[model samples]
Target: MLLVPLVYLVIALAQVQAGAYAAQSTAIDAARQAARQPEGAAARAQALGELHFADHGLESARWTVELSCSGDCARAGSRVTAAVEARVPVPGVPQIWGGAHVPGITVRAEHTDVVSPEES
Candidate 1:
């Protein structure tokens, strides 16, 4: 017989995905702010600091930020990015899922903020 608990497990998995998305979104916001400033050590630091605050609720790990000239990102501006994958165990479907199996959600987002001459 198909277990009904499995249905709940699927729902939980979806929730995890939401969490990942939220975290990445905050990271992007920080990147956008940083991009507005000129590429420099201090500017990057401020941007990253803001991002950390934004990711307070979401899982924050392996934060990444880069500055590029031309292409998708211009040097005057910068790109901010964050990535994380979290594995959440099914709450009520342990038996249905068999051992330590659960759902894994991975998310990544990039933000590009224009760097003003003075900001740089």
Candidate 2:
């Protein structure tokens, strides 16, 4: 009845919230890790390693991270930015219903950190 749909809505909302929080944390952690690295390649590698979603109930979510630099990433005082995007599928939704596609919530987050002088 009405209660079933309401429960599904609540579950979808909770999943979206969890995905958003995870994306934010991932962006922050990736930016910090990249800022600590000494080169662009190393920074990207470190940042990719920090993108963890399983613990946040986003294990089945599609997610990706993009990194950018203000200038030379290895240079002191430069800024490293990490952007994370996650597509979380809505729960209790049929993959195909009346030609309707699976609904998903897109969560995004960005964080920036200055490259440490000591790392340069």
Candidate 3:
């Protein structure tokens, strides 16, 4: 009887956890793809696009991406890193309450890849 509400809450929390996992997976994939790209702007745009495609409910505006390259990024053998941070939305929960807004869980991921030395 009393446990029913608790069960529902647990289910809701699990859904939120699933969303967080999805966001994290998307971030990781996006970072890895961006790190493998040669152009900066194109890479960022493509990564964002991919993220949005994979997670439609997740807002692109809430995500931040950082790209770092060791040495010349365009040069072969250079290492590139892409870091992504995103706020995972809780299902059925609004961000605002009582004139104040609550924040969602933050998930972050990073990937590093080396340019092919022989490719360019």
Best by TM-score: 2
| Model 3, TM vs. native | 0.63
- Candidate number with the higher lDDT (1 or 3): 3
Prediction 1 global C-alpha lDDT: 0.46
TM-score of each: 0.43, 0.81, 0.63
lDDT of 3 by residue, 1-120 (tens): 999788878875775565556545655555455445666644664566456535654542255666677888767778777666666555556645731344556766666777665544
Residue 86, candidate 3: alpha-carbon lDDT: 60
Candidate 1 per-residue lDDT over residues 14-117, each given as its tens digit: 65565556545544555555555434644554455445535543333233434343333335433433232233333444445644444344444544445444
Q: What do the candidate models score in CA lDDT, each in turn?
A: 0.46, 0.78, 0.59
Off by over 4 Å in 1: 1-3, 37-103
Q: Which ten residues in a row have the lowest lDDT in candidate 3?
A: 52-61
Provide the lowest-lDDT 10-residue window in model 1: 81-90
Candidate achieving higher TM-score, 1 or 2: 2
Model 2, position 9: C-alpha lDDT score: 80
Q: Which sections of candidate 3 miss by over 4 Å? A: 1-36, 42-56, 95-100, 118-120
Residue 93 of model 2 has an lDDT of: 68
Instruction: Write candidate 2's Cα lDDT for 57-99 as tens digits.
Output: 6777777888889999888899988888888888766777532
